[model samples]
Structure formats: structure tokens, C-alpha cells
Target: MKRFQRIAGYLVAAALVGYFLWFASSNLDIRVLHELLTPPVIGTLIVAALAYAAIIPVTGWAWARLLAAQGESWPVSWLTAVLAVTQLAKYLPGNIAQHAGRAGLAMREGMAGKSVAITVLQETVLAVAASLIVGVSMLAASEPGLAQLPDGVRPVLAWVVPILLLSVLFLSTVHLSPARLATSPTRAMRLLGKAGGLPGARIALPALAAYAFNYLLIGSGLWLLARSAELPAALDLPLITAAFALSWLLGFLAPGAPAGLGVREGILIVLLAGVGSDGELLAFVLLARATTMLGDVINFLLGSLWLSLTRRIAR
Candidate 1:
């Protein structure tokens, strides 16, 4: 039964790829890919890959600091690996694998206290807050299909849940106080006190900047890829930014969509249909996905190799 389920998942993922490919055919040029992968061009690809790899550590450090803001410290290298692998594990069945990866890291490294859980929750809160704040700000500026709508247009009103959720999160964290926890979770409150001069909002502020910068880098890549593929210059920056942002956010939350392959392209397609020509939009999305995946592959290799070498040197 397990084997059968695994096979079914592969089929479903493959079907999604086939569907994506049909639309992305124009941008999946064999020659362009070869050019991009060549020895001469590989250097530029390496830089992109390294930038992507660096993002994991930077975000991990910011989050690790959030933990320290509660006067706790954990192994960041281990946490970074767990985060990276959790991202890769999202493609597995049910997304249980991904969550397991995160929870397992917490338990294995002696971070099984209530304080760790509190810190983890705080990190999740800050991340979502940052994502949606940028998202909402950009979504309002979306062009709303000027000249013509792309396809599968959902109502803007549907986004209220995520926006509201984000708003509530920001309010809660911004005014968070150790005194508010007097009646509950005393252990966690004590840890917060040990943070000394570091305030909770001080920790929260940096997560916002990190997430926004991460999105900005990825969005710029997508935008440039679109132009390279000859998409419209007059295209709305806000629309692209919002669409790309949602794609990343949803891809993270989505089950069994490792590296967010299916959800990423699928969401991009739907977003494009709302605002750009189907053919052109699909072309650029394909380019964006390829660039992103290629970078991921390189990052995984470099990180894996670096970890292996460091262990050997220590030995």
C-alpha cells in the first residue's frame, strides 16, 4: 500500500510537470540552457548558486538570534541543514517529512524545552508576518490585468485571510511583554528575561528585514529572467513582486511540493493568466524555475561538500 501511494505521488507530480512544460515550452530552449551551463558561463551561475546557499545561513542566523533573544543558543550549522533539508523534503508525500525534519532537529540537539518551542513559534510568527506584510503592500499595488486578463482569475477578496492573519501577528509580536506571561509558561518567561537588554521587538524587526530582502532578491531574479526571455518591459513591478511573493509563501506551506516545484510554477501560471499573455508569461515562469532549481542544486552540492570537509578537518 505504501509503495502504491508513493507511485501515485510520482505520477501526480509528473503530470503537473507535463502540464507546466506545455506552457513553458518556449522558455525551455535547449540551446539557451546549454549556453547557461557552459564552462564560460558557469562562473555566473556559481555566483547565483552561492547567493542562494548564503540565504539559508543568513535567515538561520537571524532566527538563531531570535532564540538568543530569549537567552538560548543552538547549533546554527545543524539548524541550517535541517532547514535546507526540510525545504527539500517538502516534495515527499504529505509534507510530514518536512515537519519531521524540523521537529527532529529540535529534539536531537537537546533543545526540547518549552523555551525552544516558544522561540520556534516566535520565529514562525515573525517569518509569516514579514512575508505577508511585504505581500500586502505589493498586492495593493498590483496592476489588475491591464489591457487583458491572463487566466483562472480569483477574486482579490479571497486574500483576506492571509492578510488578516498577518495583521494580528504583527500586533501581537510588536507589543509582546514578558509580564503578560505571569500566569502561564513561567519557564519560557524566565528565558525571555535572561535575554537581558534585548527586547522581543528588537529581534522581530530583523526578521522583517531579512524576509523582505530575500523576496526582493528572488523577485529581481524573476523580473530579469522575464526580460531576458523578451517579456514586456512595461510590465507591472508590483504585480510581479506580489505574484512571486505569494508563490514563495504558498510553496512553503504547501504539502509534498519540495523545492516548491509544482506549486511555484502552478501559482506563477495562474498569476500570469490574471495579468499577462499566457504564452509569454509561461515562458518567463519556466525560465525563473530553471534558474531557481539550478541554483538550488548547486547550493546543495556546495553545502554538502563544505560540511563533509569541515567534519574531516575536525577529525
Candidate 2:
């Protein structure tokens, strides 16, 4: 049954990617993509790519802080290095690979399997909550009328409310396992009554801050990419940030899409269509994705080399 389920997941992911490619090919002009490679645009893309590289460590720090909350504290540097290599797994076929790779690395460092599980879960919840909150706030600030319009406000609330609830629930659950308790089963079930009652488990303020910075870096990189494409100056920056965040969150939530491929581009094209002609919007989406990929490739190679050298020095 598990095998069947896995196969089904792969098929679904492939279908989603294929559909997006077909749509893109029909609407996108290849000539515009070639045009985007001019010297001025290339300079902007390099800047955007560097911003993306900065985001990797910021996100790793957030996850490391979450793990620290669970009593498996590691230096942010080590965790950042580990995550830099493992995060590339998201580009692979199965979504589980990234988490699984992280789990293996943590276990090798003597972290208990259950603790790793909880840490990953907590980090994901915190990250998503931070993303949604920042995204919605940007939208509201950019267009104050959104606050007055039920139609506009409802959709944002629909996502935000549940995410907020889930974050609270997860935060509560994090307290159940006392960090000092040596035994796993016993520690997992020992729930403290309330927030003030548990010292080890308050709120993850550092994690929230880290994720917020990470989101800002991501949005800024995309903004630079938009500028590289010579998008209209009339396009509002805050609105673009909100749109990117919303589209990114939606794409990440989608089942089976590797690193949110196809889904992210599709959503971006739709949201930014008003910024320019259909072909130009399509070019922006493609170039943004390409610039991001360039950053990822550069980081992955550098991170791998760093990790390898560190291991040799220890020996």
C-alpha cells in the first residue's frame, strides 16, 4: 500500500509539472527570454542571486533555533552547513527526501529521532506562520482597501487563521516533552498545563525573527529580478512582495511538486499578469525561476566543498 501511494504521488507531481510547462510554452515567447540576457539585466540577476544565497543560512539558522528549543542544540554554523547540502534534496522527486536527509544528519550528530521529528515539525509550522503573516501584512499595507473589502480580506484570513491556530497548537505541544527528561516515551506525554507553567517552552521568538528575515530576503531577490526584466515602475513593491509570498506559500503547500516547480511559476504569472503584457510577464516568471536556480547551484557546490573541507580538517 505504501509503495502504491508513493507511485501515485510521483505521478501526480509529474502531471502538475507537465501541465505548467504546456501552459508556459503556449503563452511564453522564447525571444523575450533571450532578450533578458543583456548585460544590464545580467548584473541585476547576479545581485538577486547573491541575495538568494544569503537566504539559505538565515533559514538554516531558524531551523537550528527550533531544534535548540527541543534540547538538541547545535551551533548554527554546523546546522547551516548541513542544511545547505540537504535542502537541495527538495529538487528531487520525493518531498520526503529533504526531511529524511535532515533526520539522518541529525541522528548522526546524536539527536534522538523523535526530537528531530518534532523539531522539523515545529520549524515548518513557524516558518509557514511567519510567511503568511508577513505576506498578508504587506498586502494590507499596499492596498488599504483590502481591509474594507470582505472578498479580499476573507481569503487572506482563511489561510492566516488556521496557520495561527496550528502554530499555537504546536507551541503547546512543544512544552509537553520536558527537555530535561531523559526518557523518550515518558517525556513525550508529560504535558505542562500552560505557557507560564513551562520554562523550557515559551514561544520561539528567535525562530520567528529568523524566518521573517529569510522571507524578506526572498521577496527582495524577486523584486530585483523584476527590475532586471524592466518591469513597470508603476508596479507596487509591497504588492509584488505580497503576491510572491502568497504564490510561494501556495506552491509549497501543493503536494508532490518538487521544490514547488511549475506551481510557483504558474501562480507568479497569473498574479503579475497586470504588470505587463502576457509574454513579458511570462518572461519575468521564467527569469526569476532561472535566477533562483543559478543561486541554488552556486550555493550547493560551495556548501558541499565547505562541508568536505571541514570534515578533512577535523580528521
Candidate 3:
């Protein structure tokens, strides 16, 4: 059954990627892209890429805090390095490569496998919750953009309100005091894992905040990309941020889409439909992808360099 599910997931992911490629090829204008790549725009993309790269350490710090909360002590730098390098694995076949890679690498660094697994779960939950919080709130604030969404998406947006409420309730109830780390058998902890208790509210809440901030950084990068393209001033940073966050959530949830590649662009195209001309929108999507890819590469290099330097010092 698991095998069958995996095969179906791969098929769905492939179909989504194929559709995105087809759409881009059909709708994107090469001439517009060439015209859009001005020197100033190129510089702005570099800055945007840097902004995306900055998310890694913040996420790493949050992950490290989760580890600490669970009685695991590891330097934030080490966790950051592990996270930055392994993050590139998301582009691999399964969308889960990064998590798996992170687990393996942390284990190599002497972290317990169970702890890694628990932190991964906690991180995933927190990340999704943060995305929903930002995406829904920002979307609500941008009534014009919300009104622009297609009818199909409007229904989906309507469900987000209740979902967000339920998520908050779920998060509120999952807190475990630090004293109960070893003996807590609460259902949530059992689900998270019995060996290592879930992080307490003090830790989890702050980590959740960090994850939310990461989304803002991500949105800021997209906003910069839009500004570089000379997109309309009326599009506003909040609307673009909301669009990217929502698109990011969709892509993140989509099985097998490498780092939410096709799914994100497709959703962005739809969400930002009238903000710019179709060609301009297409150009922006492609640029956003390039900017993120560049950021990932930069982060991987920085992480690798950090590891190498630390190893040399140890020797």
C-alpha cells in the first residue's frame, strides 16, 4: 500500500511539473524577459537572493531551540550548517529528501535519530502553522487582491479561516512543561514521539514566531523581485507577500513537487493575474524562481564553507 501511494505521488508530481513547464513555455515571452533583465533589475535580484539565503540561519536557530527544549544540546551554528547544506536536497526527486538528509546528517553529528525525527515533525507543524497565519492575515488585509482571486480559489480561501482557528486551538493544547519531557505520555507527545517530549510553549511559540518571520523574508524577496521588474506601485508589498506565502503553502503541501517549483509559480501566476501584463507576470515568476535557486546555492556554499573551516580548526 505504501508503495502504491508513493508511485501515485510521483505521478501526480510529474503531472504538475509537466503542466507548469507547458504553461511557462506557452505564456512566457522571451523578448519580455530580455527586456526586463536590466542592470538595476539584476542587482535587485542579487539582493533578493541574499534575503532568501538569510532564512536558513533563522530557521536553524529555531530548530536548535527545539532541540534544546527537548534536552538535546547543539550549537546553533552546527545546526545552521546542517540545515543550509541539506536544504538543497528538497530539489531532489522526493520533496522529502531535505528532511531525510537533515536527519542523517544530524545523526552523523551525534544527534539521536529519534530527537531528529521529533524536531522534524515539530518544525513541519510550526512552519505550516506560521505560513497559514501569515498567508491568511495578509490576504485578509489585501481585499483588492482577495477580490481578484478566481471563484475556485475564493472557496478555498473561505475554508482557511476555520482551518486557521483549528490550528491555533491545536497548537495551544500541545504545550508540554519542561519538567514532563521524559514522562509525558500525552497523546500529542506520543504522536510526536514518546522518547523526546514536544517543546514547551516557551520554546515552540518562539520557534513558531521565527518561522513566521521566515515567510516575511521570503515575501520580501518576492516583493523585491516585483519592484525590480517595475511592476505597478499599487501591487504593494503586503499583497505580493500574501500571494507568495499562499502560493508557498500550496507548493509546500503538494507531494513530489521539488521545493514547490511548478506549484508555486502556477499559483502565483493566478494570484497576481491582473497586477501586471501576462508577459510581465510570467517574467516575474521566472525571476522569482531564479532568485530562490540562487539563494539556495549561496546558502549551501556558505554552509559548506563553515563546516570546512570548523573541521580545519578542530584538526
* lDDT top scorer: 3
Q: Which stretches of candidate 1 lie over 4 Å from their true place?
A: 1-51, 75-78, 102-107, 113-117, 142-199, 234-237, 252-256
Score each candidate by Cα lDDT.
Answer: 0.60, 0.69, 0.80
Q: Against the hidden reference, what TM-scores do the models get?
A: 0.67, 0.79, 0.87
Which of 1 and 3 is ahead in lDDT? 3
Ranking by TM-score: 3, 2, 1
The C-alpha local distance difference test score for the whole of candidate 1 amounts to 0.60
lDDT of 2 by residue, 159-253 (tens): 76567656654654454435334334543334322111222335466676677677778678777777767876534566667667777776666
Q: For all candidates, what are the clash counts?
A: 4, 0, 0
TM-score of 1: 0.67
Worst 10 residues of 1 by lDDT: 145-154
Query: What's the lDDT of the predicted structure labeled candidate 2?
Result: 0.69
What does candidate 3's lDDT look like per residue over 1-315, in tens digits? 988876776676576677678778888777888888899899999999999999999999999888887679998998899988987899987677888888888898789887797788888878888887888877766766767777787777677777885777466457655346545466665543464445557787889889889889978887877887887764667787777887877666557777887878877877787877777777878888998899999999999999999899989
Pick by TM-score: which candidate is best?
3
Using lDDT, rank the candidates from best to worst.
3, 2, 1
Weakest ten-residue segment in model 3 by summed lDDT:
189-198
